[model samples]
Target: MSLEAYIWCAALKLDVCNGTPFRVLLCLADRADSLGYGAYPHVSTMAEQLGCSDRTVQRAIRDLTAAGLIREGDQRYVQHLDSRYRPTVYDVLTTALVTLESRGDNRVTPNRSRGDKKRHPGVTSAVALRTVQEPTYQDSSRELTLVTAQEVEEDQ
Candidate 1:
């Protein structure tokens, strides 16, 4: 779906709450689209539409970047809008995630079992916690603690 449409649908379906900015963004972005513009908004423009200050827009941009929903690049990124890129960002991201998960590295994938594991050499069980301790309760009140190599060094 178009970014603007996606945002609008999400905002409307979610009913503001945390979606107000995205709703505003979608509205402004749609307006920009109608103007025959591929305008990558400066924070001020975004803020004006969202009825927020520039800082708020900036924060949203930063959050989007951190979440990998948006990215920055030199002129090349703009020239090849990710929306137009073959093997779009979403495809590449999901493929990469799948690759890692098949190798038993991603924490978010399920359907992993011994048969699946045998397919990949050197893959460890995802459920296996590489912890150093076996829990031993000191008293009725159980307090969990991770044993570390440091304690051995201190003893020596």
Candidate 2:
């Protein structure tokens, strides 16, 4: 059980994953180890826990694997009178960087007339104005280009 893995899964953007697939990922993350590996739960168990059908759980797993967000580990096999394949272990892959949108900036502003001074809004207009006027920042993929001023300063 790695808290870090769970937090990372929770912070993922909706564009990356949402709905059933997102829930399935979060469940795997909860059972993951410190290095974001070792999540082996039966499909039936996951279905029961998530209040969905086993087929639904399996579909979610397949979708997640297809998206490269998870990878199947060694297959578990059972030996005895049952002699059946056990639940498969999975590893959560976080190769893609996800950026979360701030709650303050996501709010939809109400439309107002140009000369409408009747609204006595408290700081909402100011925040919306600032957000509208703020310059868009593009993240560079170059390794040598620092994205923030707080990062390591290179000597000339």
Candidate 3:
């Protein structure tokens, strides 16, 4: 599957996007299927579906681009997947640019008096929670050995 599909899927996991953006992502993926890999369909398709001009689609693409969710290329764009951490393209793109992340163990006390209707000045709440996912666990035997060695040394 193309990277756009993966991006759109992740975006949907958040409950904030509107219908137009949803249609943009959906149609973009459909067109990507026909256009094949490394093919970025013209913005008109999104325009046609959303009943807006190509400029609107352009802006939406720009927003996604600025958000680090996609990478723009020569008259086309790539999903700019973060495959090093996860197999899927664009896995948690938001986390990469996240300036601040507050989690269950690392909670950031919000300045409730500071903003009447705002969350944070620099960080999105969605990214905050995902930050606590922690590091990968790839070597169980190594961890056991290290713990055992530490225990033995401490005993001595």
Candidate 3 residue-wise lDDT, 36-146, digit = tens? 223355576558767999878777766655654445322213334343322211222233223223233322222224343545555667775576566677845564334
Report the C-alpha displacement of residue 152, candidate 1, in angstroms: 94
Off by over 4 Å in 2: 76-85, 95-156
Stronger candidate by TM-score (1 vs 2): 2
Compare the candidates by TM-score and give the number of the best one: 2
Clash counts per candidate, in order, are 0, 0, 1
Worst 10 residues of 1 by lDDT: 86-95
lDDT of each: 0.43, 0.71, 0.47
What candidate 1 gets wrong by more than 4 Å, as runs, is: 1-17, 20-39, 73-156
Off by over 4 Å in 3: 1-11, 33-37, 73-156
Q: After best superposition, candidate 2 residue 96: deviation in angstroms?
A: 11
- lDDT string for model 2 (1-156, tens) is 778778888898999989999999988888876545668777888899999999999999999999888897534322222437467878777432121122232312123234546465455776756765665556645466446555545431
